[model samples]
Target: QLGIVTATRDDGFVVRTLNPGGSPLYSVSELPLKLARKCLDVFGTASYDEESSIHSLNTGYDDEVSSIYGAREFCLLRTTSGKVLYCGKPSALGLKQGGNAGSRWQELIVAKAPKIAQVAAGHEGLHAVLVGDDGSVYFTGTARRGEDGD
Candidate 1:
């Protein structure tokens, strides 16, 4: 089965996950431009030295965005516009989100270099962790107010 991603402008997204011994599952679509902008608003400003388009913007994350599980991990991200972004890892769990951005919210970048099992979204930012046999929780994206410290 093939997993297909779908996206909407003002509304959320839905994706179709095709798997064996399972029914067709519809989920959110990929990060579309409009949706990307909504996400950016929540983060802060969309910075572009020169390589940037005015319509929509997004970044998976660089060597930044950390998870308690490991360094250079992708946490959940609240783009400037309020769109929710998540990395395809484990299945979506209790994953909860609200209207407030963390006092020190950080960007969520999914690390694709290594295979991921699951990921989740939180207040300040996003949190991601690898799947454990016994099922213990890992940590990521714990932003404080400011550097001087909030």
Candidate 2:
């Protein structure tokens, strides 16, 4: 387990792009050594700018604005396979990265967790206003203005 990962390639592929970060993303699966090198370039050249990254990653909206305690900013993630998701993070979790609730795009819905329906961002955190089929709202995260939710 030396920990050197490699690519599984195919034929009829070509090198497509190499980012500024030295990460080489390829299209040619036929080329092994070159493909791996290109893939590495694509990964390495990958840049991370805070605001831009966050905006780009915030893709969709399904979660509604809420008065829930932890509800922060959110997104609706429909997988390529066509699964609907209403999700977000609590203020406590939102404040950190790699917490239990992480956004898929912007809204992170953990499997087995309740479906977070709506979200409204607050000054310190966000509010997740959740609703079950019974039409009841469950408030969990922070409210925008110091509990007053002003």
Candidate 3:
């Protein structure tokens, strides 16, 4: 399978996944402007260094997203406002159960790790790495091959 994430001019995001033409099917999800504001508002205002890629929400910049990474089963969005969002298989996110059947844009709550600066998702694996504003690093997903930093 393959995935794509695009940022619209209206400060919203769209995600699409294409599965091989066999058993599974293709899917698409969108994060409209209204919901985007709600997500950003959850963290109040944004703050970052002048030289940093991070930026405040709704600053009218071309792209408020700092970076986007996709793994074997999911995708991670790191915004310029220092927030992290995800769309894809919830199990890849370590959730035992309870998630949408398909992918959807949802906030990734990294307890005690505020203001994510960067994120790395394994394209061929289920692991993910997050770098915080305070230089703290966090990992999630399977422990396969000790990629979880055990």
Candidate 4:
């Protein structure tokens, strides 16, 4: 089954479960942007500049207003303005404890590559693949099964 996730103009999102096997996090038929934001802890707008480095309107991470993708356990959002956001299990992304205690959105940072052209999430949200505007490809998350081609 395919997961459904859409981003609204107000920086909010709509998530739906395609089947009963869908995760409980998005089991709800529809959740308002405000509520979704509150539950996912998705706040702030982040921007990246080649010269100025990375900056966030509120948090340390950011994403533009554009497309959003829902995976089994996480969501990958890519904006037309060249930013990427990931929200889901912090451990799935290999984030250290204490800093990301709860599920929240974080920017996908690729060294020297400030702009992102596309983003993709792997099954169960265990891995992420990103394409940078500079033609650079980035991969994050776990690879215990050689899913990352390591």
Output the number of the lDDT-best candidate: 3
Candidate 3: lDDT over CA atoms?
0.64
lDDT (Cα atoms) of all candidates against the true structure: 0.35, 0.36, 0.64, 0.60
How well does candidate 4 score on lDDT at residue 21?
65
**Candidate 3 structure, TM-score to reference:** 0.54
Q: Candidate 3: lDDT of 37?
A: 44
- lDDT value for candidate 2? 0.36
TM-scores, one per candidate: 0.21, 0.27, 0.54, 0.50
124 Cα displacement, candidate 3 (Å)? 1.9
Which ranges in model 1 have alpha carbons more than 4 Å from their true place?
A: 1-114, 126-136, 143-150
Q: Encode model 2's per-residue lDDT on 81-111: one tens digit a residue.
A: 2233433433443345533334343444444
**Model 1: how far residue 102 lies from native, Å:** 18
Query: Model 3, range 1-150, lDDT digits (tens) per residue?
Result: 667777778656767665666565766444343233432222222121122343333423343676767666666778878887766677877966665423345678888778998888765558888989899999877767877767
Predictions: Cα RMSD each: 16.3, 14.1, 17.4, 14.9
Q: At residue 98, what lDDT does model 4 achieve?
A: 32
lDDT of 1 at 75: 27
Model 1 quality (TM-score):
0.21
User: In model 4, which regions exceed 4 Å deviation?
Assistant: 1-64, 97-103
Worst 10 residues of 2 by lDDT: 38-47
User: How well does model 4 score by local distance difference test?
Assistant: 0.60
By lDDT, the candidates rank as 3, 4, 2, 1
The TM-score measured for candidate 2 stands at 0.27
